[model samples]
Target: MGSLDVIARALWSALLLCVISFSSPLRAQPEPIELWHGRVKADQPFLDKLFKQFTAETGIPVHLRYIIFKNLKVELIGAAFSNAMPDAIIAPADFLGHYKELKLPAIPDSEMPDTIRPRFLKTVELDGKRYGYPFFYGNNLMMFYNKSLVETPATSWKELRVMKPYYDKRNIELITFSYQEMYWLVPVIGAYGGWPLEGKKPMLNTPAVISAFKFYKGLVDEKLVQSDCNLQCSLLKFEQGKAAFLIDGTWSYKRLEESIGDDLGVAVLPYIDGKPMRPMYSSHVLAFPDYESQGEKQTKLDKLRDFIFRKDVQRQFYDEIGQIPTHKELASLVEHTTDPNRKAHFHQLEHARMMPIEPEMSHVWQSLIRGWERYSMHGFSAEESAVYMQKTVEREIERDTQ
Candidate 1:
């Protein structure tokens, strides 16, 4: 045993240790949970604050990206094809229709926070599985009036029609709304005893649709509503006291309250010929995409979900933004609140129907808008327009399914 042999053995041992260290994998750092959403720009700050708080509490960082609502779906599909999809999406419940296409795994019902209202939870459930977390509900249209201009809100369209001449003489429109939006037209169809969707099928070619078209045109012909005005125009007219009433969705409540102050009065949609104007409503949801691929990231997402649905967090959603919270207790508070506007909103929700959650409902919307444009701008007869809508949507559904 010489000094040379002792040095060679030590060198060999060091070389082997270096090779093993280089070959073995080091522990990987946790990835930030990535989320994509189509919510309005105003929501970003509040959402950022929430995410920051979550990171502070759990040491798990979150990254968010905002995509335009119209473009969100196409991009999600594109990303899915490219294997570059985000971990989750916050979007309207209609995105549930893409659950299969996006390979979004069902969020076990047991994993869902019990604080969410049952009805809101149902929006994300299709067949028997829950695919998303219901964030908030109550996007529906109601009639809002200027109390100073109209002493009483009209409960019936016939009564509203009777007040047209009075408003005309005052050089003000009796009512105003975004005349071309198909969302607004759903209530009209409901008043005529039709729903655009009955399960997965669209009922656009019915007598109800024809009547709805004719009724809307009659309002324009009788000078009861301004057909040329868009939503912003109608909002401005109402704010400036130029219009006695406006029809709009819950999303505009805070803005209307700010603009009109005490003069803002909310009411359920006016009735037509003994039928109620059942406006369509829907919930916004937080959905996971290709969740099975997430592996250990699921645990972090679980914490994020719990944080997002916490009672305090849900309440902030209402307090900060005008978004209605989906927590049962908070929704009950709003339902029973002394605030007249909140009460009116709850009452409207009582009469409103949830928008069809089926993916095919998208076709109904596209077809209905086309039919409306034909009747309004192209001079197509109501019956013709109705027939066109039904045929078009059916064709689209068939083509898409195929």
Candidate 2:
């Protein structure tokens, strides 16, 4: 009970308390990874299932924050500037170029399994380093027509032209968007052996581009296509049964199924000649933010990445959300041939094309779409529109390069 004995006993008690605190499960547990994603209704079932499965297996909790697609970029940029970015994000391929410019954290091809990397049509890279893992890829653009009304589907754009009599007699129009005019144009451009874009340049000013523009313009000029057709209007026109053939992505399959039910007949978008041009394909990728404390975050991010690509989760994603699986092994897991229309969608992926991932690619797409719009909406000459598009694209490329 002397002063020295009391001091020794007090020191021992303090050390014991420190050890207990260090070993406590509550104190040792890692923080949950924060995930930011778009709140698409199609993804809900998959998210619920995957989150439950992920938490159960890895013991790493995921906190999800949903942001609208339009606002997501702005919010994410603000978060990045403030050093408050999410641990992981799910965004479209178009936005990947912006993330590349910001130098975000990404999982490279070398890091991913060999089977998974090759399935991705577009390489998700930034500064020669891969930055994202692709999850859902939809490249198939099918023409949805009412089978009961139209007995035979058009196999080519030329065949589509022949159906003008049927369309005019029946007063049925083909619905399409100016932006998606690329789908119809691609086949024609390919028939004439033209590329959508040349090496870092837009090539829409070519003879092929002019011809394709004129083809669509002729449809409008002849009153075969609806004059007010744009992205929103086209889909609406199709849903209302005013149009026979609607050019749209595979993502519209579920919505169409729910709305139109068995009345819908799906056909691959036809080529100009015998060969069809590939439909533009892109995917949603998971990427990490550039973190100050990367070491700890990397460990959690790697675990989440692995969990996402697991076979069971990928299968669930395909089944619940019509998102095409990225895992090569799971690609065939979508084989529910019960629905012939859905089965055709899987077949269409064989001839799909991914959009260019270059930084100036958006400008290229915009310029091409503008040219098509001017030719279709206004009375601009095809040659004039093509020249304007090519010049605008060249300017955009030069600006981005500088």
Candidate 3:
């Protein structure tokens, strides 16, 4: 009974303890939150600082994946089909409804802190459910002209047309495009008081739309602007001194700085008949996808959302990235802007109109692009283009409404 039995029993107890410890689950570290975003030159520094701060404070890691702008939609769709969606995505505002239709998780307004709600634009809401938080917002319809070329910028479309002869005489093309024509001709139509659709029906035959079309046709006919260049080409033309003015967004400041150097200038889009034409402004929004609908992940998302909208984070976003803060109070956070031309961009935010957030916006863009091609490429009259656009608009509205 003695020492042998005592030693055997002790050994058995040690063996049992080792088995229990080995079988137990290892303490797992929290998984890092994955964020998918579109290609942005300005966002890197802000995000790097943000991720460092987040990790230091909460021990929660963040991973970022930037997708090419043109490939984003297709990539998202492919991810959704394969059940490989990222935890969160920053997508274009117009594409929100499409994501919603795909059953992505909705970020309710109530989920956001009350302090952050008023800073966001109302257009971000759809069917009373807030989908995403606005990050970057601005119009591309505005033309930037070289002040040295045109001492006084034209105030309205009428003046622009009147000055065409002078510009042409100088052998300077007023505008250049990479493709066949401009993308958003909606502003021109609006300038002429043309509504593409009347109460969800096509109004292609309206007088206002026809007049707007004629205005663009006149510019083409006068050879003031080549119908051949697109956004990229237009920028190149302006940079090379081939053109004096070009229509583009605020995001182009960096590129212009590198290309045009000391000659860059900024101004709002020219008005039409003394009335300012409202142009579509694109925005990026942060959204939670459907796959993250439960458990510890949802709680982490809520915290991350709060972190993103914090004043310090928002300030960092604006200062480093050059994006306008959605928070009205933090609008002045971008004080580090060195270029005077860049500062001029901040003033245009108020007049900027949000792009259509409807699900059928894709269809509308397709139809609009085709209509522009017809008028600019072929000999179609403005009246014919207007009629065609009106029908397209009506069809889009009907498709979305259903």
Please report the candidate that would top lDDT against the real structure: 1
lDDT of 2 by residue, 14-97 (tens): 999999988886755768888888745556666866787788888888888888765887788888778788888888765677
**RMSD (Cα, Å) of model 2:** 6.4
lDDT of each: 0.86, 0.72, 0.68
Determine which window of 10 residues in candidate 3 has minimal summed lDDT.
Answer: 195-204
lDDT order of candidates, best first? 1, 2, 3
Once superposed on the true structure, which residue ranges of model 2 sit more than 4 Å away at CA?
A: 1-32, 68-84, 106-110, 117-122, 125-128, 164-192, 273-275, 332-339, 377-379
Q: How far is candidate 1 from the true structure (C-alpha RMSD, Å)?
A: 6.0
> Model 1, stretches more than 4 Å misplaced?
1-30, 169-171
How does model 3 fare in lDDT?
Answer: 0.68
CA lDDT, candidate 2, residue 11: 100
Better of 1 and 2 by lDDT: 1
Q: 1-402 in candidate 1: lDDT tens per residue?
A: 699999999999999999999999998866898999987665678889988999999989889999976799999989989989898788888788888887788887688889887878777877778888898988899999999999989999899988888988989889899987888888888887889998888999999899988888788787777778887798888889999999998777877887888989998889988888889888988888887877898898888888888888888988877788989898878667888877888888888988878888889989988998899889999999988989999999999989
Distance (Å) between predicted and true CA of 51, model 3? 4.0
TM-score of each prediction: 0.86, 0.79, 0.79
